[model samples]
Target: MTILGSHFVDFDTARILVADDDPILREFAAVHLATPTLEVEVAEDGVFALERLQQGGIDIALIDLDMPRMDGFELIERIRWDDQLKHLPIVVVTGREDMVAVDKAFAMGATSFVVKPLNWRLLSHQLAYVLRNAQAESSVRSRLHDLQRVSDLKDRVLRLSRQKLTGPLNDILDSAQTIEHLSTIPEISASLRRIAEASVALTRVHADMGEAERLTPAP
Candidate 1:
């Protein structure tokens, strides 16, 4: 990870897509977004952008609102609907100040908005923020999934232990109880005490495992 301004950017594995009809704007975005660790790919239109996205490994998309063939809004909607691309962060770039357009872009699932005649430096920071936040969210989801798997495995183990060990443990407890009742000799009584204590310990362990199973959160 490399520090850009106040934010840490792990751009070594980050791939960005810049989609715009204008060659100059696309080049400007590509250049500004690119770093030694980051790779930026440009698309002439939404169609090309969608194609590149389909190919995968695009961490974020910088898209122009107005373009020929497929517009940004349509592209955004399509991307949002796609299972693979739904979680992808998209920042819409537009010259229009119209609230309706902005609202529509957001409604269609644009992660952020950037006005054209771009501030290259600020744009870089904004993109970094979006990427970082997305990455963080993704990390959280992955960790949650791993935790859930562990919880599930614990539950399964608890169930199996109870199923397999319960009968034998009960037998041990029953035998200890019988020995306690029948034993009269001092040595036999002492053995009974040890057996009772061991039985109690095993029962506590079984109960604790059951409690852990109950406490384990559902996926």
Candidate 2:
């Protein structure tokens, strides 16, 4: 299906979990939400939903506020607390007048909310929007982490390059000094002097690199 401002969404590869105690609502969601590219899995209650989620492969979750065994509120809390499931996008599906439940769902980290008497025609589009936005957010976070890693590596390389050059530069300077001391000829002494000056300049460059490395913040 097409999402606004983007290419066609490949729902087929998406695995959606519908958690509700009502059989009719579960069937309705499965029929309306399913597509050629998408697979919808139904859970009779929050406990079953948690079990399936723990088994993994759930890309998104549609949770009902009222259910037997665990209920959606508690399930959302458990999911948020679990490291593996904490990042999963959750959409709370509830009654239109359930404002209290809605607020609690958001506070518990529900990605979004949907009101029922299910909008059969709009369900797919709405879900697509939520999934797209969640995916975009995840992509941005991943890119930021990659950029940080690259920046850190660059800083480390700069530090290592300076360290590797320091000893060799000191040895070059020492050799230049020895040559200048042993050679009494004016031309030879002048050449050694130039060599020593060049070595000192290179050493200063290395020192500048060290200072820059220190100033650069760690990622």
Candidate 3:
């Protein structure tokens, strides 16, 4: 989540927004983004998209150039001008292939463009690429905002696990010391059993810590 690396993967669970006047087209795009890995949201038109953007929570917008009420270009312009929405990544998904339209879209702050009849594979690839770039950009901004939260999450896991380990580890150490002191007892069988149990307990704590470190993000 921190850095949306440069790679484009097909089965990645990404949140995508689609805005199209035609329900069929919108549905088509939405369905394509809905692989087992993706989460898709739809907006019927530019107006609806603006509302959704205001509400927030969208990772990327897949917009149609031709629409009713407010067109995609106008929507892009408004999005770029709005301070709150300025950084939102936009990808034009439309039938219009006119150079003028493409130029206008870029001018209005679109990050990528895809001419439509809807190629699912290509669209998926493009979306993944756009999302990755968006993530990189977001990561930069997140560093300024609350990246410390990621580190906090890692620290919290370590703290809780350490707390849980403390009691068990102390018990293991005490048992080991007791076993060492009781070497004279009946063949020393009880001492050996205690020492073996303590060793197992200590091994588990360290093993769990190693697994936790591999799973948790570092800052």
Candidate 4:
């Protein structure tokens, strides 16, 4: 339930998928991961696994590196490109111990890696850790997105307010300029010219404010 000393997965309420080309291995894993704790589904290959995933309701996935129709690497790529499933936790279970393959799996967004002929006890603990971390990460990302959206909305409001203020200032400056040019009184014209200058300054201030608002980051 608790992972890395933080957060809980509530595994009893979770659903997991096990995909392998070997029926015996698949069945073994299904039995191993299944307890009163977690629900498990088995797929014979990557193709079937991907199909079942798209049908929805999968929280975590265990994939075998070798399979017919489609391989684990290709399956990871497809899952990464899917908007709804991109964040799903993928754990690669393979006998291959090559450093290159391990790095490649991480690069492809695998949440974890495990060698085949699995030690069921360690795997159960690892799976619990992965699920807890995944849930915590998702919660953080959702909060960040909400914060960004609110920030963007605030920026737009400031920009629109500045824009509304800028137009009136511009009109006032133009009217003051016209009145100043037509009048013969030097003192009145000087005051009008000062008023026009203040209007221009206000316009510049709002123009800068609008630009700053536009530069705010989006969600």
**Per-prediction TM-score:** 0.73, 0.84, 0.59, 0.76
lDDT for 42 in candidate 4 is 92
Candidate 4 lDDT over 91-185, as tens digits, reads 99877566577678889888899986788767877888888889899999999999888887887789679868966887999999999999999
Name the lDDT of candidate 1: 0.86
Best by TM-score: 2
**Poorest lDDT segment (10 consecutive residues) of candidate 1:** 1-10
Better model by TM-score: candidate 3 vs candidate 4: 4
After best superposition, candidate 2 residue 113: deviation in angstroms?
0.4
Ranking by lDDT: 2, 1, 4, 3
Count of backbone clashes for each model? Answer: 0, 3, 1, 0
Q: Which has the better lDDT: candidate 2, or candidate 3?
A: 2
Number of backbone clashes in candidate 4:
0
- Model 3: CA > 4 A from native: 1-12, 144-219
Please tell me which model should have the higher TM-score, number 2 or number 4.
2
- Model 4 spans > 4 angstroms off: 2-12, 96-99, 172-208, 214-219
Q: What ordering of candidates by TM-score runs from best to worst?
A: 2, 4, 1, 3
Candidate 3 positional error at 37, Å: 3.2
Q: Roughly what TM-score does model 3 have, to 2 decimal places?
A: 0.59
Instruction: Give the number of colliding residue pairs in candidate 3.
Output: 1
Candidate 2, run of 10 with poorest lDDT? 3-12
